[model samples]
Target: MKRWIPWLAAAAVVVLVGGGAWRAMAARQQQQKALAQAASQRAEAPMQLAASELVGVVRRSLVLGVPVSGSLRATESAMVKARVAGELQGLTVREGDSVRAGQVLARIDATESQARLRQAQQQADAARAQVDINQRTVTNNQALVNQGFISATALVTSQASLESAQSTYRAALAAADVAKKSLEDTVLRSPITGQVSQRLAQPGERMPIDGRVLEVVDLSRLELEALLSPADSLAVRVGQRAQLQIEGSAEPVVATVARINPSAQAGSRTVPVYLAIAQNRGAPALRQGLFVQGLLDTGRADVLTVPLDAVRTDKPAPYIQAVRDGKVAYLPVKTGARAVVDGQTLVAVEGAPEGTVVVSGRMGQLREGTAVTTAATPSAPVAAASAPATRPAP
Candidate 1:
């Protein structure tokens, strides 16, 4: 009985130990199952966004410009020069003085020219008197020849004397006419209605040859000359609407393309185009020789444009993120016309609403079906409000 009791005690100890090991293994398995279920739920979770990550859209007027740039110049300018060598006795006008065509401007010394005129007149009178006296002699000599009181030789001499007097009178008359013209050339006059920009001669100054007297410029009308390449010139045409900013004017002046050069300069490959300012678009302040910059509206264009900030270009191709169905989705878009508004150019998107919000956040980092609640971007301005050509020059 003692041996049996010892064996039973050993069996009971082994069974108890086996049962304890089993309970421990079951508890470990239960804990591991719970951990796995929790991990699976976490893997299927959605991402949330911070409110501060968004930016606002700015709208402005986007003017399509076919920019052709060049300088300005006066339409009519003449460098007046002295016609003959003489003393600049009298100068009537100063620089900036307005003058008319055929108006006398200056005078030169004419004492010598007057003397020549008088001398020629006296010679002509003497010749006329001599011809009168010779005519009487010729008449008397003819009668004497008929009466046999004079020889034929004497009659021929009388006729010759009358012819000589006639020739001398003609010669003297020609010299007198020349002297009269020289005397009249002493005073000068303006060629056109314009302001004298430069005064090159002074009183008592002797001018020899074609001496420049003054420089006159017509400032009433102005022309703008623009130099552009072949392709650009081809795009713009005559009579197209053009907008330009004249130097020193905060506002821009309006003009129209007056002329286009069909042929281009060979070496520069540039064409010279002219723009005439519309009178209604300006005041007296806008004069000639004011440097200007301009753009021509080649034609009207229809295009879809969106704020550049709403579109992301950090990638190889341009794309925008859109919020749909409680989530953020990476939408691939093809971009088109780009126009500047408040210094931002909107990249065009297809089939998009007129004022749609493209996710400007780091949504490029987010995948499709991401849980998102879009907070509106700050409201700023509409781009068309700031259009460049809306207002006329003041």
Candidate 2:
């Protein structure tokens, strides 16, 4: 039994040594995995940059356009006035109230005119009675003359009286008709269906002929009147499309050019153009009398463009990025006319070719030979092959 114990003790030592070696191998494998993970983290550090944000560009028509500024106004407007002289008994309208055509807005006192009309009618009736009496007398006198009972001169005198009475009745009838019209003219009625822009007269005030009492404007058909130079006006044609931007609105209202004045303005050297607004069909951002600026889309061409946010202006020179060989470089850009594409304003670069990488938003942190990771950035080179061509020194 003592000899077997020695052998068992040796076997136990061997098992312990083997276990220690296995643990060492396991620890080495773990350390290797940890090192690989650390390297991956280092490589991913550049991607942590919040400066690399993506931006979009706006797409628009290639036709050249002339920009103009203008104000909105109603199509129909009038200064409603009083046509007859009388005291205003009732005024039914106020400023900013809507009214229909031929609606009564005020009433004038017509009591005196009514009485005059009655008097004229009474006079006409009396005249008719006198004519009848004259006719009877003329008939009787003629009969008496024929019978030799009345003189010839008496018959002639009776006929003259009858004619005079008839003329008086005709005159009285005309007078009564005139008085009826004068009374009707006292009611001040609206000549159009529109809103009241101003009210000048009140109840109980006497107005003279042709005195203005209210100002009205029609809002259904509104116009955008833009003043542009004669040369610029030539670029715009009737039926062209127009977009209007109201203050504080992100989206704009669309309209169409309706008319253009052929002649230039006297003092401003400008010509007037009108746009008809489609308010009911358009978005709800538009309203009457809204001051706006406009863009006239004149249609598309293939042009070199970059993301609006990608273009950087903070550098020593305004520029964008050119990526190659896993690194990015700055290229100075000369910009030209701006156009909107896909709701983005793209500044046209003179010589920048297509496929150039523009450092989009927050590009201030990037510099020459900066290592960049475009694996996540859209439309960017996944793996660059070589550096970009350098601008030749002067």
Candidate 3:
């Protein structure tokens, strides 16, 4: 009986070991199957994206233009200068003060000018008295010659003396007029209606002829002068519109090409173009010398286009990611003019047909032939539905 017990125990141990080994093998097989199933589901699953991530290539009017940037300037600006040399006085207007045309802006000391005018007037009076004496002498000589008290040649000589004195008197009067003009110039006046931008000369300062006093600018008419290459200038025409972004301004201002310089700028060979601001209620207030940059719309064209960022250059050739047959397809494209339209910059493309769906570069790079679907589609379901939550008991 003891020997039989040993054999039974050994058989029992063997059975227990075999059962455990079989259970482990079954569990391993189930885990492997689950993993394979999950991989298959993942391979079939499509990448889900938001509707906004997708953009359609469309044929639309793309604004064609060249970049232009320059400083703003008032169309009507004047540099007030002193016409005569004297002491500056009564200069109350400072920078930003409003002025009217012909308004008295300042005055120069008139003491010297007044004295000169008096001197000229006194000289003219003395010359007039001499002219009167000459006329009387000529008359007396003529009377003597008629009475045979003097020869006719003596009357002719008296007439010549009278003419000479008259010429001197006329010369003195001309000098007096010049002195009067000089006195009037002492009072400086604003030549145009505008706001003072600079006050160069202060009261009690000595000003010379042609010395700068104030700089006034009319803000009503503002323009930007941009230098463009000769090739770009050839495309720009008067009345063509552009949108400009001014430094320190939040809103963009619309401007029109006002004029084009006939001759190129020296040394640079760049043509200068003037752009006049188109005033509107919503536009921010602008000032002179503000830096502005924008695109000058030279023309427009209807072409297939996409967001400029979508044109990827990572490859040797420029290409865009497009969804065709539910898979990502990279299509090489020839890029043309780029412009801002509807506030988004678009580049003209030639490879993609109109109405083809394309992905934005914001989505990052996507692999070719990868299945893609929008969140609105029903292709993707929860993985738990297909994945085994628990393995069968082994």
Best by lDDT: 3
TM-score of 1: 0.60
Give the per-residue lDDT of model 2 (tens digit) for 1-394.
Answer: 8889989999999999999999999999999999999997876566433324533232222434456557778878888887777887678789889999999888778887888889989998999999999999999998899999978999999999999999999999999898888888888788889999889988778888887889888888788999876656766789987777777787777778899887888899888898887776546644457788866654323345555456677767667766655676667777544545445445545456665555665555465776676645444322211111111111
In model 2, pairs of residues that clash are: 57-341, 58-340, 58-341, 58-342, 58-344, 59-341, 59-342, 61-299, 62-299, 310-360
Candidate 2 is scored at a TM of 0.56
Model 3 lDDT at residue 246: 83
Taken over the whole model, the C-alpha lDDT of each candidate is: 0.70, 0.71, 0.84
| TM-score versus the correct structure, for each prediction | 0.60, 0.56, 0.75
Question: Which 10-residue span in candidate 3 carries the lowest summed lDDT?
Answer: 383-392
Residue-by-residue lDDT tens digits, candidate 1, 197-274: 889989889988688888888776567888876666766778887778776777777778888877888889789888
Alpha-carbon RMSD to native, per candidate: 11.9, 16.3, 12.5
Q: At residue 347, what lDDT does model 3 achieve?
A: 72
lDDT of 3 by residue, 155-273 (tens): 99989999999999999999999999999999998888999999998899999999999999999999999998887887889998887888877798899999999999899999999
lDDT (C-alpha) at residue 16 in model 3: 100
Instruction: Locate the minimum summed-lDDT window of 10 residues in model 2.
Output: 384-393
- TM-score of model number 3: 0.75
Instruction: Give the top-scoring candidate (TM-score).
Output: 3
Ranking by TM-score: 3, 1, 2
